[model samples]
Target: MKAAVVGLGVEGIKATKALLDYGWKVYATDLQTEIDLEELKISISDAKISTYDEKINISTNNLTIDLGYLDECEIDSSDAIVISPSLCNTKIAKKALSSGKLLSDILDKHKEIFTIGITGTNGKTTTSLILKEILENAGKKILIGGNAGGGFEGYYDLILKAEKGNYDIIIIEVCDMTLEFCDYAFNFDLVGLTNIGNDHIDVHGSIENYKNSLLNFSKNKTTFIDKNQIYLKEFKESNQINELVEYDESNYDLKLFGKFNRLNAGLATAIAKVLDVEDFIIKNTLGNFEPVEGRLKEFKLNDSKIYIGKTDNSDAVKSILNEKYFYATFIGTPRSNEEHRFEILDTVASHNPEIIVLFPGLEDTVEFGLYRLKSIGYEGRIEIANNLDEIISLLAEYSHEDAIFIGGNGQKNIIEIQDRLELLTKNCN
Candidate 1:
């Protein structure tokens, strides 16, 4: 057997080793020209595989690594193509799909494991973490990963673990990127949808297409969704689900803030009930569950309380705005198109914070967001922090009695911001 692996990311590297262990000739291609094959070999050489050491001893003569896209010639010569989730929409991936050679065929090996998939435009991480807490307290061995980010294992890792019987249940945080390519490949035992909103328009073309993609991916699976979701009727009318359970807002005592988080807890509680987790365990877990870092994790600095993480979507902003008025709110450039950035600015302006701080994001959308805020007739003070240093200086100006809110939609600078705030907090103490 032979396989052509596209995109030499973490998942692609892992897939290459797995295929080699299965005695397949692997052809790996990546756009970058600087992949260290020897380093990869050394890393995997030390990898602890309980049942595959003998297979790992095989000759490297069958391996071929290249620095370019998988050309048509490579596609013709290979029996299968393994793609990284990020490259699912690339031309090579489309060609592989047309040829019926997707490596997702390997997903069949994981069909017997109990899988719980969690997805939404927002709040999925909070819900997944809550469920992890509940399941762990209930004595269930679970591997939680997939788009939960922040060093959690990914989908391929989960598959490898499932193959080894290393988990009692696998909880996967499904995202639009993965669903675009892997939908219908495996049926989840249970799925929880936090809620869907306008997001990832650049990836899916439009909100309608994004919603349809989610609906299609969720079809034929037992899904748990928010009863209050505007698209609840759409899910009901799709008539594509095996079973649909509407989870209500949980009134359980929660340590996390915001109404949306309660809804997240509600979904988690609903799923835990379906899994037969004890009521005491669910209650205890909810009460004790701390906020997931970067999802509005709170920190205190002297008399001021600072919240950082995940203010990227309108629903998340609305949740925070509704909870209380902030003295100042810092928004990073949203990871979406210009129109969506304006929409987010509108949401923030409606809250009418005393001041709005525009921060740099993964993209250079900050100036546009500032313009949109002004055009929306925002009456509050508007300031732009060109970099992290400026943002830190702005933070220092706020009085101890002031409450501060800072975040954006999946900004890459969030950790740096959080680390700086932690240092500031320590200095105050």
Candidate 2:
């Protein structure tokens, strides 16, 4: 079976590896130069992908990613096309759908199966992973993937393995990117809409476009709404939805912590009920399942100081509402016309915490927040750590005084930093 995997982003890289593992003649091409090819080649080789095409003898052992202008690549003859991270582009989505190619829009193919789709701005990843753990613990063979964020790279192989008539429930985190190319022909047994927030405006251009894309994803499925507390509710009509089920804490004992997680648990439980997972198993899994690393993940220091990685979205910082002393961090600022930087800064200031450390890596991103902070005449000790080690060391040294280190800005190595902090603290104690 000949297959073509599009784009070379993280998702595309993973999908290409999956296609090869499925015993397919894989044609993986990206629009990158020779220099950009090294990292991707290394990743594919590390994954040990094997291509079946005699013409394209690319094996994981011989990791050489071939590059071509998109116009030149031979995609027409491939038996199936997998549109992944790259499908975010409307032009590519339009081209693939119009081509009449048998396209697996996402890595986890949900054709003729009990599939659950989750979408929203922020909590999708946490909710998707939580739901997957709940279903799996219930002894339901589950295949979970789709831009839900928890490194579900090789889900296609899992689906293929399950095709031997094994798994019952399949959970997929369907992002706007995945939904853009998704043939709405497929419907989910449960559709989870966590919450609508302003995000990815650079790609969609407007709030209306972003909200519509999400609403379109939940259309006609067993839609799960945590709450109707979304600004975009004005754009949607209540009567438009067919079988909308609103889930809240009164329904199930969801184990995940935080108000945001509580909301996610509500959605997960609703889907579990649809799949008929036992209440006992659902409760057990929720209690056992820990938050994924680097996402509000906690780390302790020898001095008894605590650091929490709150990096994904600004709204994620809201999870730390009750905590008194929070040293919040942030990353890439929103595009010029896209996002508002003051909203987060204003919220952080409103708390009137002991200290605010702003370490925005991309100088420009930090400037917006810094400017906003200065405008308020806030005289808290605001310091910037240039590198990851500096940030960790700073947190270790100065943050010993009963303060919560909220690591976010330019902390891409958040998981590693959190792990090291925990390990160091353990040894010191």
Candidate 3:
């Protein structure tokens, strides 16, 4: 069988490899041919897979539109087109649905198979990882990948490969953008929609749009919902799904402290229950599951505390609970809702935090947070560091007793920060 993997993102590249591994002739395309396929560990010498520029204009014989808004080729004869996470493009989804091709949107495919699709603005990664741990502990042969769900590349092929093994359950982390790409929904045995927050408007456009996208993603599945303020009682009335479980926030018996995480743990527990996983196993796994990297990861300096989380949008900072005697750092860009950023600043200021460090990211997105902080009557101490290392150094110098938070999309930089922290920890020892 021949498969076309679209978009050169991590998901696309992984999908291409899975196709090639399964002995399928794979054609990969990306608008930017310079995309670092090597980072995804794709070997150029592999004969089964070929990467080409989006403008290459292939023959109409066997083509698939992998890149959104760049679908100039024809996919009339391809056996199937596997659209992975990039399914965010409405046009690509429409084309796939209309073309009648053997379409497998990872989100949709997850729904079709005995899969668990987890989606939300945040906490999906941690929730998916926790659920994976729970299922694996139960001795169920499982395949986990997609979004924060890493490892296997192509979803369908992974499912096929698992047939040779003894795995029964598959867990996936689905992003909102890819929600529309689902064609032939594999309605998950269990689904989880983590807390909905004001995020990803650049893609989803509006909060309602984002919620609707999520609703679509969980089509006809036994879904578990985190009690989101925005989506509260959202699932209670939905007749589309008969097995929806409204997870209680208080049922989260995990070591993860944040309210958001409590919701995540609760949702995971609800899903685990659906799978007949024992309560003790669920509770133990929840307590054992530490926050995922770059999301509330705790790093202790000599006399300071630093917490890091992915902060592509400013709304992430709202998750930080107000506490006394701790200075908080607002890292990364701000979002469309300046109120959220200002609210965070006011919260920090009200706490009279020892310090407020801002890492306005390298893009326009940073403005929403930094400016909001300044406008919110916070004149005490605000310093913008060049990078994570400088920020860490500065934190070490100022108020040694205060807590530090490295927030935002800047988290991809944590690997370097971890290296530096290790060096510092070693030097002290």
- Candidate 2 residue lDDT tens string, 343-382: 5565666667656766543244566666777898777766
What lDDT does the true structure give each of the candidates? 0.76, 0.60, 0.61
> What's the CA error at residue 270 for candidate 1, in Å?
0.3
TM-score of 3: 0.79
Q: What value does the lDDT take at residue 137 in candidate 1?
A: 98
- Which regions in candidate 1 have their CA more than 4 angstroms from the true location? 1-3, 8-26, 30-65, 71-80, 86-91, 94-101, 148-151, 335-339
Model 3 ranges off by over 4 Å = 31-34, 40-74, 84-95, 98-100, 103-113, 148-165, 183-185, 227-230, 250-253, 323-325, 334-354, 360-377, 426-429
Candidate 3 per-residue C-alpha lDDT over 26-92 given as tens digits, one digit per residue, 9 for 90 to 100: 5566666445555435333432332354343322223232332344353444566655555545566
Clashes of each: 1, 2, 13
Query: How much is the lDDT of residue 310 in candidate 3?
Result: 66
The model with the greater lDDT, 1 or 3, is 1
Per TM-score, what order, best first? 1, 2, 3
Badly placed stretches (over 4 Å) of model 2 are: 32-68, 71-73, 85-92, 105-109, 148-150, 154-165, 183-186, 231-240, 250-256, 302-307, 322-343, 360-378, 409-411
Q: How many backbone clashes does candidate 1 have?
A: 1
At residue 208, candidate 2 shows an lDDT of 77
TM-score of each: 0.83, 0.80, 0.79
